[model samples]
Target: MANDTNEFWGKQAEPFRAFFDMQGEAMREMFGQMTPQGLSGAIPSATMAPGDMAEWAKVAGELQRMWLEFVQERAQKDMAGANPMDPAQWMLMTQSLAKQVPMAPLESAQKMAGDAMQMWQSVFTRFMAGGDPEDKPDLPRKDRRFADPAWQDHPAFALLHQTYLMLAEYFTKAARDVEGIAPDKRKQLEFATTMLVEAMSPDNFLLTNPVVMKRTIETKGQNLVRGMQHLINDLRRGQLTHTDSDAFTLGENLAATPGKVVHETPLYQLVQYSPSTEEVYETPLVIFPPWINRFYILDLTPKKSFIKWAVDQGITVFVVSWKSADASMKDVVWDDYIRSQIEAIDHVRDRLNVPSVHTIGYCVAGTTLAATLAVLARRDEADKVKSATFFTAQVDFEKSGELKTFIDDGQLEMIGKLSSEGYLDGRYLAATFNALRGKDLIWNYVVNNYLLGEDYPAFDLLHWNGDVTNLPAKWHRDYLRDLYRDNKLVVPDALSADGTPIDLTRIETPAYIQAGKEDHIAPAASVWRATRHFKGPVTFLLAGSGHIAGVVNPPAANKYQYWTGDSSAASLKEYVEGADEHPGSWWPHWLDWLESHGAKKVPAKGKRKPGGKGDKVIEDAPGRYVKTR
Candidate 1:
């Protein structure tokens, strides 16, 4: 028994010892190469001599051969024990083998070659017939893919465009047909392939991109140098530095809404905007913005501010600005969030002398709000909430858009390992979100900031998107497990905070729910499912634009229209069929509904200064919590 124990422990220790020994050797080699004399000596002096292109080429070839050998050896070792024929091990073995095989890419290349032949033949025929080759394209073009006219007019560019499209299609089909692979893994593979294809687009390369080439020549390659500098800085920082952070000041330019920090906890700060109207509603409206991003999305600018709009409309608005979690707040769970939000609400109630306050929540905050309401209902404290409003929020995440592809048993377990360390870094969230719309978010930036070498314009929405906040490990894990992975939000008593099991059906608070028609985060159909869970009178609205634009839309803009209907329909399909289309922003309709439900116009009381029992005013609106990161 002693020998067996020793053998087991020795086996474990041996790996660590070997690893450290290898690491030490690697460190020594790295340091030796880093020395100025050693670095200079490593490069062949003959290759460095003027006009010695042949020597340089030989060196490059040798380096390439060495790299290939190393990769081949590593791959062989990795695949040594895998058996592709075994039924039980087939999926794993195939996945490993797939990494070594470029079958799909080869097929795509073949197809592109054939297509190129046909295009050249067509061009030759047009030229021989005394017809202009630039008159029209032989192949039909996709509006969204390669819309640039230069791509069609130039033979080289046309060939490149067609090749890319064909290759992208082939890769996509191959990704989907990755046989017997787990759904999450398959999705990840597909996403990765999509990103690669997008990155390889001719428009991203300075040589292939006429627009960028023109700009480079016009600017004397200064733009290219600047872009290289930006890339180096970002790599050094280990984060994609989006936006010129120096462009916008927090309080002055971005979240500049006039308000006071009436109360605060370690988790959040409650901002009560000073009323601009002579009279305010009897019931105060408290909003809980999603903690995934800063709260300033609601108060972006004076003209586009939702908080200011609400305040101006005779509503006393209070917003919960969540604190950015760090390592110290890793233990903060769902219960902590619920408790803190309730405490904030209690403070608002006491300060405003209002019995029941109207509650509003957006996205993740809305989900949390619903959970908190259910918990409160279980405790017989549901009367504190007069009415509830959800913006682009979903309690039922069955079909929660493309983002759902990242949620699975394997992925969640991996995420759990990372979460165990501390807070889930915000960069991961940003990257995932960016991946969802690669063309618009990721590839667009790659072209503009990295390729075109232009500074991103100081757009408030983009700034808000870039300013990410960390999520507590425990809280985020629970959220994913309950709401996302297991679909617990719709399951009665399946989700709970503290000791109480939350049942959404038990909460009879009249609710107003809005979902964006084009919301990729939370699909309107998924959000509409929440209507069935609520026992109270529910009003559902489907807005025209995407997640952020739908909610932040003001009436004056009249940009996107909306559809409104009572939640009497049996399904989302039925509701949409019967819903009435409104020509402008849904804010006026919401205000009217709110006023009818419980909000009453009254003579405005004296402005309440920022302070509360135990927790006094720490700072003005857009408080310290919002500025943590």
Candidate 2:
């Protein structure tokens, strides 16, 4: 707090060599804490020589001098609560440097004149001696954008792709090298630049991309004509099509696990799944999935359905199907969502005649569940929830990854404007998330459906991803302001749900927190930090893949693995070192931890079922609410 300026610029800036050492350590920490080593694949493949570092430092200093005004202007906006800087500007500035100047030099003074000339000569001599520009140079790891065989085999295509990468590298390096700015702001600038660079890739266009062009040539332009049709269809729907929508029937194939919607509310519908075993756990399991989207991610299919799996394991499972907010739900605040959870908890207790139930909260729902637990504890009803499990839920926002880019002053204001009609449209939230992974979620579809004119196959995950939902403006506003931006959720009683002060430390329920090793939305670092907030015995698990793939992982697939670590490790590094890697889904491990929480089994023959209670059955599993949008 004391040093607004890590100020690695100006006269007081740390010595250039020392500053880079500090930067290196910070970069290591960021990636080391957020993901496993193999996942940090975006780093430049080529390493810098000692002399190159000095030249790079000089270039950086020159860049800082040029961009200092822009940073200052942004700082002013930040202080005034203005939108500050737009990402497009970041892209334009970097693009200009790469185009306007060949990144020539800082040759005004005699400083590095000999070195600069030698550098230029070396570059020219090296290229002239090289056999072919078509021969691929060392490039960034994990960049599958140029994976097509033609990109590697065809001379012209290879040259074109390599040139694009050079320009991209130049622009990104320039944008990321800006100094005289705070670290958080630097990250936003760097990320925005990278996004634009990724967007402008040669592969995204029909003409420049070899594969798309090849297909168009072979199809005699019919590919482009079909692509136009897809464009028209997407325009009508107001978004890109990620899957063959017709292939998935919600209640039939997608959310197909048999169950009954026993309880319904304006905000959510509680679906109590029929048990698959003769005996079930006395304590039921309740899932509060993210309202920002549908709950069916956990109940996708018989093979991948977590709900069905639990049911088969002699555990009765109930999941909340949240209502997509409309104009009528405009006045709903954060507490209303909290009350809905409390209501669902009580309803489950009353219907099943159980003292407590195990609960699982995925993504945003998990954050609110923590607050719900605090509310329950403060209200002297903490016994209602037997145990808690969080799937990629971030309570501490300090290391909340790229999602924060959308929380800037201007973006938040834009959200406010969009939500004037009570809540922000589902499309807006969906678009924001799509932009985060624009290369895949946005542009990949753009090239496939609009350029290559390919029809997307039926994919359950993409189908689920496309079914976006509304975000309550008031609740969402408070969420962005108080939680994401303000960092108040970690403080004791700093937040409240309808006047009941919520505190995380007050809740004593045992917790099993699962985080994706590669989760970007709810970063591993951010998720791991929450373990310290709970006073109970918290068991933290790290799963392979990302937020969606990791949580939806099915053991039978025998795919990616997971890791178990000590919750109280001193740091993320220590925590990871202490981790014991396991070769399967974390679902079985979670079930074991849940059962050990003292939930007794009772005969399913005479179980006090949800439908027979006063609440009664509303409809079938994955009820009418999920199908609303």
Candidate 3:
């Protein structure tokens, strides 16, 4: 037992120790070349003779030479112990590396430059002839691409757009060829370079953007003054204003669903929504929304509220509204999350007099719920959960899209340092997420709030996005390291909450897994992989649009689309190939599936009354925790 404990801790601490050791080695090497006298001479002395200036300059030169030599030595060290290569072999290796670039095989910079010049000449000639010069280029349609029509029509804007695309492609290609760096580090470099280029995009700048310039002219420079005011306000507050906060009030407009918090804990508040239908499902449904954002996302507005839709579908719903973590909750870990969820589930089960409850987890919450269920299953308590539903959530992290780039050892170490105060600041996590969709999330706001001087639309979705929540340091660290970095959840005995091994296959409860077709955070493929780990019947649904839009889609809007398939297929590819496309939202389909399952109809209890022991009303619906910054 002692050896096993020592081994576990040693494995956990190995990476950190190696990181510090490398840093220490570098520092020692750096200082070793500097003599005491030379080091002291480099600094400007309080009293010095005129001759000391030349001496100082000479010392500086020597220091510079030493730095260059050190860098060269480090570079050589990275390639040490490798097989020697002839000129031909070296050329072949270089060629092999270049092939990794997506565009390298297609065209060279010189060729692309020539193409750009020809296109520019044609555009200029057309403009001179008083014709529409902005013909849309045959570029691949991408959500991240600039969508302004003027970018194609105006020669100047067109040129700028072309330049941006070319540079982005070049940088991505170069990033792919960055040798001697770790794979994750290379990905981080690629992501950083892409973000930098996106930040410098012409569409984000007042002077370069045609729309902003036209708006400025129309507003008679008043827009600029307003923009300055916005900037000053944001600077003073140390936050980037994302939405017009005055647009929506919490209970009045946003989380207007009729409900009451029946139970409260230090971790979360459980709100039971009043049933709208005369008869409701005998088996109650409880939702666990990701704590990264407020739970109100599920109850955004009546028109788009999932809670309302579920209640109207005759399903009694309970949502977990999590409290934002602070220093006081620093000791909280995954075990705490699991314990709170189990407690909430037990309370709901006892109150409703139901043997089991249906569970729904969204995003990160889905991951947590899966872990919780696994822990329960290990203890022969799996029957507490009647069924499981996941919304755009992934258990497997192998192909977890762009978010994986930020989970490397270096970034995780830095996050560890930042969260040493017991909590990972919510702002940092929010900013990182925003950076993933920089053009739409970050620069769009910059152009609107700082350039056009426009208050963003009071969109409920954006409002929910802006309502960020902090995470306990221990809990978040466990999440990133176990799930994202090491993928421990999928590996047997690799994960646990209360010292009991978790195995996803033990979760035999029927599952309904939903994935967004264009979800950049949790890729559809990654989410689909979760279906394989569960032993019971699984229904995989693919929704149109990205993460937020895909999950928030309501049937009343008659917008977007979804695909349904035989979840028992051998692989995700097989399922997707055989899936039948369905029109409109997947909510109705999901309800139908739930009805077909074990969700029997029972008389609606109308407004919920507190019943469980110690279950007293904390406050009205959309509890105080939702209002936390």
Candidate 4:
């Protein structure tokens, strides 16, 4: 009976051994087909290229190493009975391996043929483009090491490249298997690891191929040109940054100085139209800024600062410099921010004796200002504010784009975990933003400075981007959950800071909404939606450039083109109609609008000194907190 059972088992093993042999044969055949001519579907009777021979040797060496490792790992697994492939797993693995088995040959052939073509193309282009022989044109800009001229004639380069190509093919095949495996059971990782090890074989780096070298040469050449262009562009921006300082600093200096006379209104005081002024309108202006960033982006260094321009034009400038949330104020929320704006307006009213205030809200601060207006409207205190300005602020979230990707459930959970500590550290906030646009700020610097051997200059915007601010945990949670993720701001019956559901329609103030044509964060369409909710007249201005550049517009740097004229009341539709408009800054247009309605008088030298309002100077203007991290 025992002899009969052994015979039965041996017979079963015969078929399994035969199947394994066939699979191995298929793999060998695939590897053999990696010759350039074989891959190109043509047979070459001529001798093998010396470079191709070198690549084959390198591949053989790496394959031998991988085989040893695989055998050792398999032996360990067999001993431990830890084979992930039990009967069911074995069947699945067999099927998966069967599909991937041909991949190595396919990849080998592809690389061999591709390299041959690349070599021929490089030799042809080098002569045709007609550059100095010494200054060979670079091809692929990314990999500079591949640009060695010796690669064209070196036999080892061709061989190693071809080998690596085959390794890459196998690696890709294995990576696909890994991706297919259940996340819990990463059986494919072992295969992927083997593929990566083989692809990065030391022999692969021994000699660079002509194809790779030519690509490098071309890429390096293009990078050289691009670097020059970037330098020129940076220099121009530097000049603009300098010139912008002159424009904004002049205005800020005047405001900061004791008695440097400018317009009829005192530099720092809100200019309310009295019977004494040329023109009088009921609308008063109050400016709101988030404590997260420096207020100067709205009022950057002189000709650039919109605040200075607005003040000079006799617009009532009640700017709110939000006190940064300190350790003691960890529990501050959306309600607190809104209340601060309300208090600011009341302070301006009590101090300047203005009956109604026009509110200008900047970025996130715009949300609070809008909320304040809604609160006022809810209580029938709309009389307090006559007009409102929203600069790159959103109440609607339908088209929030990448920002939406950021506030998903996982992010909320992470934020919740982080906020368990006191404050949401500001540096983390800055880092998040930096990563969002890392290609330009971080990677670009690495490529230019490290790879291209160039120096990166000090960029003020980059500097500012690095400066981060923390949000109070409660404030961030509420802001994200209530307003951003939930679309509470636009909903008429949504729960708000007050017990009653907030209604934006109650906001009857005239609105001046300005957005950038290329603004990514708050698309003009989102900003335009506010007009639909507000029961008031709306003037939407689409300026050129991105969020920051659009808002901190300088008249001197008329780099941006704007859309204007009697257009439709709709935001996006008007923008579409106003495309291809002439070049000019949005500042002048806003200035014209304000000047037409602002209080008018001769430049005044009224000796009212801004002595910090007799309050102790606890922190500097723009503040230390905003500049840190």
True lDDT of residue 248, candidate 3? 93
Whole-model Cα lDDT of every candidate shown, in order: 0.72, 0.73, 0.74, 0.51
Query: Clashes in model 2: which pairs?
Result: 83-410
State in Å the error of residue 538, model 4.
0.1
Candidate 2 error regions (>4 Å): 1-143, 606-615
lDDT of 2 by residue, 22-90 (tens): 434543432233222221222222574666444434433433333354447546756322111233433
Residue-by-residue lDDT tens digits, candidate 3, 103-174: 212225466567657656755665566534345334432234457666656777766666556555655565
Every model's TM-score: 0.80, 0.79, 0.79, 0.59
How would you encode candidate 1's per-residue C-alpha lDDT over 1-629 as one tens digit per residue? 12422242233233224423443453343222323343234335554555443443443444344445544764776633322112233233223323322222223445556765775676555434545655643553353546766666666666556655655665566666655556655665566556555655667655566676677546544565567556545543435656886788888988898778877778888888877777888888889999888988999988889988998888889999999889899788888988877887788889878788999989999998998899889999989999999999989888776776666555566556556557887766776687678788876776788667898687888888878888998788778877887888888998778899989999798999999999999989889888889888898999999899999999889889999776788888888888899888999989988998775677665544334345356678888999998
- Count of clashing residue pairs in every prediction: 0, 1, 2, 25
Error of 1 at 99 (Å): 11
| Residue range 1-629, candidate 4, lDDT tens digits | 12422232233233234423443443343234433333222212244476654544443444344445544765775633312212232233223323222111123445545755675565556545655756755432223333444543344553344344444444444434433334322323333233223323322221122442243244432333333334333333321111122232322342231111112111022222112233333344667766566554555544555665665554534455444444556778777777667766776566545576667888788877788888888877878876677888887776664455345454566566656654676554554454345444434443443224244454445444434456777888777787777888888867576554577888877777887778877777777677677787777778888788887767777676877643345457765665557687777776566555444433221211222245222332433333333
Query: Among all windows of ten consecutive residues in candidate 4, which has the lowest summed lDDT?
Result: 258-267
